[model samples]
Target chain A: MKNKKMAPIGVFDSGVGGLTVAREISRQLPYENIVYFGDTARVPYGSKSQNTIIRFSEQIIRFLRTKQVKAIVIACNTASALALDAVKDEFDLPIIGVVIPGARAAVEATTNGKVGVVGTEATVQSGMYTKVIQGMNPKIEVIEKACPLFVPLVEEGFKEHIVTREIIEYYLESMRNTDIDAMILGCTHYPLLRSKIREYMGDKIQIVNPAYETAMDLKRLLEEEEMANDETTEHHSEYSFYVSDAAEKFRKFANTVMPFDVPTTNVVNIEEY
Target chain B: MKNKKMAPIGVFDSGVGGLTVAREISRQLPYENIVYFGDTARVPYGSKSQNTIIRFSEQIIRFLRTKQVKAIVIACNTASALALDAVKDEFDLPIIGVVIPGARAAVEATTNGKVGVVGTEATVQSGMYTKVIQGMNPKIEVIEKACPLFVPLVEEGFKEHIVTREIIEYYLESMRNTDIDAMILGCTHYPLLRSKIREYMGDKIQIVNPAYETAMDLKRLLEEEEMANDETTEHHSEYSFYVSDAAEKFRKFANTVMPFDVPTTNVVNIEEY
Candidate 1:
């Protein structure tokens, strides 16, 4: 219900995975309204072409802009890697992506020079994390792997299953073989499988969730722009959930995984935008 | 070049998995001109809603109809399960789907009356195979499980990897525990993982690939209707490949897993049709 120009922050991802980013935003900025959109119909942007990813992101951003949100977050790693640059200049508002913030966090978290990043095929292939990390600190050793199966594994609610652990081992084999002190859970969905990934990678390897870092980045930008919601005025945070398709399915998923209660969700025909 | 009314069979799937069905048709009817379309852009229709899947199937069917395809095969199991009935009457052509043929094959192959089926979530939920099989023989029992990760696993080309075998064990544990003598690889993408599935299920269970059955079903319809392309003529069979996106990627995949060579491929903006 908070429609004041500075009251809402727009968050969007290819699918429900974006909720992780939104969850962090809610935790960090409780009084800020969140307008979240999930492209559920054509999700798993990890395997899609860059053009399609950009097209979808632009459509979602267009839809979000109509809501008069103060700023936007590209919550998905694949979308951040492939579509962020393309949509950045076009959208008139302040927009932040997960890639740079995540890279910065990984750089800060690592003790040893060895760092690891795992994400969808498109995100890993984009090399955004490696480029940003190595650019920030030239001596850091970056190990990257594309864990394309992680989304499906998490979506299937197999996060703690032995199957997931084996899969984690399978995907993290290259990362595990190294002496990486910090690992970035590059994809938004990867955070859901953090327990299995941690169990497989062992406690020595620090796990970094970019959703947390992206939320922190949003908080900083909001404060700098003087848009932070005044939390002391007895104003409660409001959440709006939208999906391209399968509203009920998204609602069920959100209710289970999200920290806040998801009472209802609406469907948006994202293509029209 | 075989556009002479009834010279070509239109075959389509969500993506390359339908290539398995295309491969089967190519193997069974070596002389039939095959027009294959892969909806690579909006692929893995397996997890999508019925309405979306039906809409996608109709678009692809309309596209294939333009090529003068006499008979059309819905190679993708999810589309065939959810969309075939919706599109069958409107299309004015002899349309065949994989579900019925697959059910028939499973019924014939089952000795213990307990038949197992593995497919994407949507296909399993549709229960088309169960309905068709039970309608044919009421005495038989059907045990169905949705293996949502199998598509991603195969798409990642981890068909024979230890991870795949372990994941297969995770999914098929229910079926493997049953007295089911035969199992249907209900999703077209599945045949690519045949060896691993067979290895996991052991040699006792008869593995039924619906693509092969669907191909045989098409063979029957073509012969019955006198639409079979004559091989004895100076005509050599021609194969044309089209995808909604990623022509080069589809070409590469077809070249690797197809029964024949894939020299070239074309991209189609399926939405425009």
Candidate 2:
């Protein structure tokens, strides 16, 4: 149990988008060490097929196992949608994905029982959010939208720009008409555009940030399984970052999204795993 | 020489974006067969480093060699910008990139000696177009802009949509004021947004589709090298398509961009090469 508590938690995404999840996890569980892997070389996994996403996720998981992670967080919504189930049992560690946690949050948050989901094309197409939300309560209506431009907009660093606002409005126009009391930001990158999305959706509608909820979920799971790191230790926890390409670029982007400084980042040839 | 004339010309882009280039090549060189590979599994080489792009391009070139291509066209602007020079000497065939042809055409078309170049972030950052254009004529001024959203807009099939127009105007607003007489669509996907871009820039600015110019350049090179396919063969030229993932998606996109029929597209595990 002591050794298990000291092991780092593995978190991964197709790219830096998953840093949002990592940030949230660190905020929620400050004592836990984290090892994050971003497959920057073959990013935007939302456009990829289920088989490819699964294969890539499997490879990433295999790589993370070498780091001796006590648990794994599939921080990417596309990978969570397509690859999570297939890989959940393959590894002995606790494997949690963003989909179920976000869905659970939406189910609990929705006052009108009409929930909206916004994510990449692949995630929306997977219908994982809809399945989980409906499974929780069949009466709840799920509206899934694929906002393909949102990710590009965020990557371009257009968070508060008028163009980003216009795009958000354009994507969420239909969802606004429906009485969706809660909206799940199904993509990790979507949280970066939170203000614009909230402005467009109005204050009445709850914005569900899966990263935050997933972090909370991870905290609960760790506590339940006695995997939480011992806070009694005087040593500070470390967070290590790895990407497939452009470590400098990833570091720059990481600084923008992450609250704490990322002192060093290593580039891993993800194909090797 | 006779056998060389029968061999297909190889063209490749990181993904289906190069279908725009393939369509132009087919239009210009009707008698020449084309073997096109879209590295769909690991695409958008724009964000990757020069070394990785060169490596991926080398792998693709090796695969194309197996198809007995007489010449090769690096249709991806990012690849042409970063990987072309590195791989040119590695192959015996006449290797062409969209940059030189596009730069040549821009130089020819720009009466005011001011040319605007738009492409992916990496291509624009590489300064390949600016260097090539300025090298031809030192007095010519080059303004390069990275329109990152354009590709996602086109992929979402928003070519003529108002959102696309707004985004284009937003991206090109600075270039429009610079008194440039021409703009090079440095990325193959940009050609699809030609009409909207033209409307934004007005009638005076010539929109250079590098794909078309590259095709013309290929035609000129084949003639110069005496490798033009003999039309007397009394056989129709065949165009074969290959992608690393989602053959059906690539086929659907090819149908939309390609004038002729693409009956089938094979999936290649590019890593194998």
RMSD of each: 2.5, 1.7
Top lDDT hit: 2
Candidate 1: misplaced stretches above 4 Å?
A1-7, B1-7, B224-226
- Candidate-wise lDDT, in order: 0.87, 0.91
lDDT per residue for candidate 1 within A46-145, as digits (tens), equals: 9988887888898899999887788999999999999888898898888999999999999999998999999998888889899999999999989899
> Chain A TM-score for model 1, please?
0.96
> Backbone clashes in each candidate structure, one number apiece?
0, 0
State the displacement of the C-alpha of residue B137, model 2, in Å, after optimal TM-score superposition: 1.8
Q: lDDT by residue for model 1 over B1-273, one digit each (tens)?
A: 234533689999888888888888889988888899998887778888898888788888899989888899999889888989999888898999999999999999998898999999999999988998999999999999999988988888777677787788888987888889999999988887888889889999999988778888998988787788766568678889999777888899899877668999988878667
What is the Cα-based TM-score of model 2? 0.96
Name the lDDT value of residue B17 in candidate 1. 83
Which residue pairs does candidate 2 place in steric collision? Answer: none
